[model samples]
Target chain A: MTHTVLVTGVSRHIGARVAGVLAADPDIDRVIGVDTVPPSSLTRGGGGVALGRMEFVRVDLRSPDIAQVIAAADIDTVVHMSLVSAPSKSAGRTYMKEHNVIGTMQLLAACQRSATVRKVVVRSTTAVYGSSSHDPAVFTEDAEPIEVANSGYAKDATEVEAYVRGFARRRPDVSVSALRFANFMGPGVDSPLTRYFAQPVLPTVLGFDPRLQFVHEDDGVEVLRRFAVEDHPGIFNVAGDGVMLLSQCVRRSGRPTVPVPSTAFRVIGDLARGVGRVDFSPEQIALMSYGRAVDSARLVEELDWRPKLTTAAAFDDFLQSRGLFGGMPLTVIDWLATVWGGGMKR
Target chain B: MKHTDTSHDFGEQEPGTAQVIPITAARRRSAGGAGKADVEDRLADLLAFLRRRVAGEYEVDEFGFDPELNDKVLLELIRPLYRHWFRVETLGLENVPDEAGALVVANHSGTVPVDALMLQVALHDDHPAHRPLRLLGADLVYQLPVLGHLSRKSGHTLACPEDADRLMRKGELVGVFPEGFKGVGKPFAERYKLQRFGRGGFVASAIRAQVPIIPCSIVGAEEIYPKIGNLRSIARLFGLPYVPITPLFPWLGPLGLLPLPSKWMIQFGEPVRTDEFDPEEADDPMLVFNLTDQVRELVQQQLNRLRLQRGHAFPPFF
Candidate 1:
């Protein structure tokens, strides 16, 4: 069963990896990767005839012409992964509302127009759950969308989910599945998780322990692939196998972590933003102050998908793959110091 | 505002119209009180009456101490609940008088009004003084059905001058949430920032009644049900006191009302004896207002300190 898959935002990170994976799949006859800019070295192609299966289209998802481009490809399954993950750099709510929300609506409309389209998988964030300590027992497909603080990123993510759900209700034939993913981390990833590692010195809230969950980039691609092939019709918590402390991630990444008092951290985050050295908006800082533990029981049961790597293992793999852990014998020592000193003490 | 001659009523007289004087009805029945009963016997009867009223068909769970044997059931029932959910650490019980009048002013947070209840229970059960702290509840709370009944039973009265005066005259320990709506209603963006308190009603009451004012700082209440956001329309539509989006709300939707288990530290600040100050000083608006602001500011400062001292965001349970 040869299927044509249109994966958006394939110029970087999870999108690029997903495009490569889909192109490799024998089930997928053609993989059309779309991004606003042309593919760079960071993208899927290494410049060879081997890239014949994968086609790169430089079309902004936010643009109205995206529908025409997707239609031209005769896409059977739409894997919508394009989104502004960075709160600081991303366009404001107005842009998100247009690009993420309206773009999604347009993509779904175009997919619906093609009678061959069977499924649509939208990449959502666990940010919809906000910051909760409550063990959601099992974050099933039916779990209600929770509201985050009145920030534009949360609002945009929520709006995107709403559009997908609404479209699914209207077009039942087009099996729509939304993956409420936690933080994504792996080699070649440039998310907040990777950025934290790349920093020379990590700044953490002094009194607060942030319990974070991550989905490895490969695992993220796997989930998307499964969604494309499978006929699932609901939301799922697509996260890593287990959680890790933010402080631990910083220390293990071989970065010096400075424990600034929470008040002082907020002040520093503000000061850093003013000088343009760092990008910690006040909203991001507040969001980072709580535990974002999500249950992925439903994803395992329904999608038959289990996360291959935990955050700790993934972080280690990421560092090792990048050759960043080669000289840093202090990684284990830093982890020990963080754990013993109650730095990661939740 | 024109002051009326009637103690409780403050009505305006219409222009060119005769003033309607309030009629004080004489008691239809009278009882002799010259040497009828001793103070101890009268006190016991009064306590019994209060107990009967409070225990009237309500679901009373005596959390600790035998239901039949315990002298103060309300205190006993609430103590265990507080200890279980909030590991309440109380300090400076000595500041609270064993008997008689004192004004307790504490910072407020957690969209749900648990701090007031916890403090009341703490004073009643854990305090060495074993005094009942009568709280000044907002009018909005008293307007709610079940809440109104429970509040009164739990020794909360309306935050009115007359109510404060009456309670103080009876030698009851009064608690005032001076921050009122502002403190609890402040957005999640400004969690610990103390709101401006109204002119020193609490201070005037303390000075008028010649009582000490104890300022208390309550940590952990702010985090128990952290208001992450507010759905203004929903809150307004439902006529809810406040629409709070805690981690649970965003994580579990409507089920976020359940409080997180946070360790609470209640530090009672040093008492400011109103008796030491001149009675006329209470009327000196600036003096009383400054004193009240100082007390409020002190609690805010302590809360800020505790936020730094006690490490961990979203409570330890998270």
Candidate 2:
């Protein structure tokens, strides 16, 4: 039997990729893509390229009509990824709480109403663990949830997981899985990771060199696809098999990391907020202070899934694809120049 | 045999009918020692005298109250351990009251209860008055066989209010860790952040007994066994206090039992006079909680100052 999957925020980076993957699957008869905005220039379509067996629907997740849309589509599996990832502190507050928290509530309610809906996979984040000092070893699923102080993003993600877990408990037949993702980069990561390379000077919070793990965009989509088809519940840290230092990422990007004290970074973020110079906030500054390295052992052992690319290799591929690096080594002069002088102003 | 004085200088004296032993004479007597066995016996007798001075129930079978046996066993067990693992230093010996009753409250840390034992040894060996301190051990410590036997022999009792009050009333020096398990068992990230202390049990006991409460802070106990993480599931399965992954434990496995040689500085703060307050004051829950918070804040300030002064994670090796 063909499955009708309902995917939210299908116009965004990860959501679009997930929609593409599900549409390509022969067993999936239709994928309903829901987004707040109409297909923008960034949407996944060019010229005559057809979206195989998918349909796009514009529906504000915060609207009362969300349940009606899900029901009309006859969604058998709901992959809820409608969340505001804009680093702009003010922009995400209402959006995240509504779409990520209340929206999931409505989606779960819609799924409950539809007798055919059997599974739900929500894209969660490692931010639930918060930006605190973690054990050098891999943080397993069993590790206690670290307390997040001020970041709205981290707090919202934690609330989302609680809601999903609670929903599963009430509806025993529904298989709900929350994928706590680390930093992911691939073909379309032109989203967040590219900001590091484009900015003149990549600021590094001194005294804290955190281990970062990145999952390829492809792998992220594959994991979601598997979760949609399989019967599994609870939380899992979804990322590539390995981890890297943020310093290495800077080096790989051919950009220099300007070492700044934590206090200075917070000051800069605050000043930016006051002057309306940038979208960064104090909470974003706090998030940047620590790196999260989560364990993906359960995803592999239980779900029988693995990343198709390592972080280093994926990053190199991204750099090559963007034409950022062309057979040249990063030099001491490049480092000193970038460190002393801030990157070209916007 | 000659007597040598190890008593510290307190400066000036109140001339009265109170018998004052001359500092020079005490030193001379302490210096005048005979054979090693005779000196050991004298030390043992001194401990017994101190124990008797402090009024409390003594159970040699259950609590192991033989001073001679304890001194011998402690000397054997701790001396080598300290020599191999710690460069131990004690300060403010003069602050310790030579008179009968006093309460010593110290900030607690280290993976195991090693600092408590070390403090007991410091009081017995180095204090000018040569007081035998009664430490209040956690309930878990008393449940272990070898640990319980050793602790009892060393004059340690369960951390119970009744036990603490009894020991203090008898004019014995009582040591209490207000921070309890939270302070010691804290993970590596939150180290040095003192946990919430229970309402002033030490203060109540001191006030009841008209004793002075001394605030003690120990730096370097945190480094001895740094708790990196904990395996909560395993700890629950085995009914252990905490499944600690210290620098030595999980990394070194069995060999991790040997602690790294960290230099320790244990300082005794000025005593708080609880005698002025009425014993009825202990009954006021708000007063007791406020007093405990005051003591905790004072200790925290001292710890912050010490951290600034030291500046290094590990002590400098000479």
Candidate 2's error at B52, in angstroms?
A: 70
* Per-residue alpha-carbon lDDT of candidate 2 for residues A212-292, written as tens digits (9 for 90 to 100): 667888788888888877777878888876555554566556655687887788777666556543435454554455455
**lDDT of model 1 at residue B119?**
88
- Evaluated on the second chain alone, the candidates' TM-scores are 0.73, 0.78
Worst 10 residues of 1 chain A by lDDT: A132-141
Off by over 4 Å in 2: A41-50, A87-92, A134-137, A190-193, A271-279, A325-346, B1-318
CAPRI-style grade of the A/B interface in model 2: incorrect
Q: Model 1 over residues A166-200: C-alpha lDDT tens digits?
A: 78887888788889998877766776556766777
Deviation (Å) of A212 in candidate 1? 0.8
